[model samples]
Target: MGADELSATLWRGRRQLDFLLFLLETQLLHLRAGNWHRLNFTASELEKVLENLRFESLARGVEATALAKEWRAPDQFTLPALVEIAPPGVWAELLDEHRRALVSLVKDIDGAVAANISILEKGPDEARAGLDDIEILATQVNIERALAAVSEASLPFLRDFLGLS
Candidate 1:
C-alpha cells in the first residue's frame, strides 16, 4: 500500500480504537452506578462496538499485509516492523510511537473486559452468593478510566497521521 493508503488505514483503526474506548467507558459508568437497566443497554452497545472493532482489525490486517508485500518483507511482518526495518522518517517514528501507545491502551481495555466478563459470568445469583459487585464495579471503572486516558493521549498522534488541521 502507498503512504496515503496506509495513513487512511491507520486513521480508521485509530478511530475504531477511540470508539471502543468510549463504549468501555460508558459501560464502566453503568457498572459503577449499579444500573442494571442501563448496564443491559450499554452492554449491547459494547457488543456492537466489539463487532466493529473486529471488522476494522480485519481490514487493517489486510492493509498491513499489502504493505508488507510491497516492501518484500516476511508474511508475518506488520506495520511496526516496517517502521523498525526502514530508515527513520518523521511520520514513521510518530506512527510507531502512537501505535505503541494504542497497543498499551488496548491491553488495558482487554484486561478490564476480561474482568468484567468474570463478574458477568457469576450472574445475579452469584451476587446473592456473596460476590461483591460494588467492588468489582469500582475496579472496572478505574480500569476503564486508565484506558480512556491512554486514548486521549493518542489523539494528537492520530490527528497528525490523518493530516487533520
Candidate 2:
C-alpha cells in the first residue's frame, strides 16, 4: 500500500476512535444516571464501532507493513517506528500526530471504563448518592456537546469519501 492509502486508513481509524470515545463517554453518563436502557443501546453501538475499528486496524497494519518494506524497515514496525523512519516531511508529522491522538483516546477510554466499573460496584444507596451529585442540566449539555463534536469531526471524512471539493 502507498502512503496515501495508509493515510486514508489512518484517518478512518481516527474517526472510529473519536466515535468510540464519544460512545464510551455517553455510556459513562448513562451509567452515572443508572439508565440501563440507554446504556444498553450505547453498549451495542460501541460494539459496532469496535468491530469497524478492528477492520480499520487490520488495514492499517497491512498498509503500514507495505510502507515499512518500501522504506526498508523491519517487519514488526509500530507507529512510533514508522514515524521515526518516515521521510522528513508532512507524512512524518501527520503520522506522529495520529500516534499522539490515538494514545490519548486509549487513555480516556481506560478512564471511562474504570469509572463505569467503579459505579457499578457501588452499593445501591451509594450509587444513588453518586447520581444525585451529578447535575441533570450539565449532563444534557455534555451530551449535546459530544454529539456536535462527533458530527463536526465526521464532516471532513464524509467530504473526502464523497469526493466533494
Candidate 3:
C-alpha cells in the first residue's frame, strides 16, 4: 500500500484498540455497579444499547469495523490485551481457574482428538494414547507455573482495571 494508506491503516488500528479499551472500561463500570438495576451495561447490555443506541454510536462501530478491515482482517484485528481481564495478583485464583480449565479442556477434548485421529490416520499406536495421557498429566502439573505466567502478564491491566492508578 501507499504511505498514506499505510498510515491511515495504522491510525485505524489504534482507534480499534481505543474502542476496545472503551468497552472494557464500560464493563468494569457495570461490574462495579453490582446488580442490574444499579448497573447499565455489562457486555450483555449491548443488545439493549444497540436497540436504543443513537446513530452516532452505531456509526462509530460500523466505521470501526470497515476501517478495521482495511487496517487488518475482519476476524481478529484487535490486540491481545483486550481479551484478558483483571490482574494476575489481584485475582490469582480466577486466573488459576482459567488455566486449569484450559488444561482440562485440552486433556479431555484435544487428547481425544489426537488419539482418535492418530489411530485412523497412523494405525493403532499405543504410544499416541500414552503420550496424550502424559501430556494431560503434565499440563495439570504445570498449572501453577502457567498461572504464575498469567499473573505476570496481567499485572498492569489489573492495576488499571481496579482503578489502582
TM-score of each model, in listed order: 0.65, 0.71, 0.26
Q: Is candidate 2 or candidate 3 better by TM-score?
A: 2
Candidate 3 lDDT over 1-165, as tens digits, reads 322332343344334333433443453343334222212233333333323323333343454355445445445432222124223343334433433443343233333333323322332233235456765455333333322321222223222322233
Kindly state the number of residue pairs that clash in model 1. 0
Query: How well is each residue in 95-152 modelled by candidate 1, as lDDT tens digits?
Result: 5765676666666566556555544444334333454777657545544543333233
Query: Each candidate: what lDDT?
Result: 0.56, 0.63, 0.34
Best by TM-score: 2
Model 3 Cα shift for residue 123 (angstroms)? 46
Worst 10 residues of 3 by lDDT: 146-155
Model 2 residue 110 lDDT? 58
Report backbone clashes per prediction: 0, 0, 0
Which sections of candidate 2 miss by over 4 Å? 123-165
**Candidate 2 clashing pairs, residues 3+ apart or interchain:** none
Cα lDDT of candidate 3 equals: 0.34
Residue pairs with backbone overlap in model 1: none
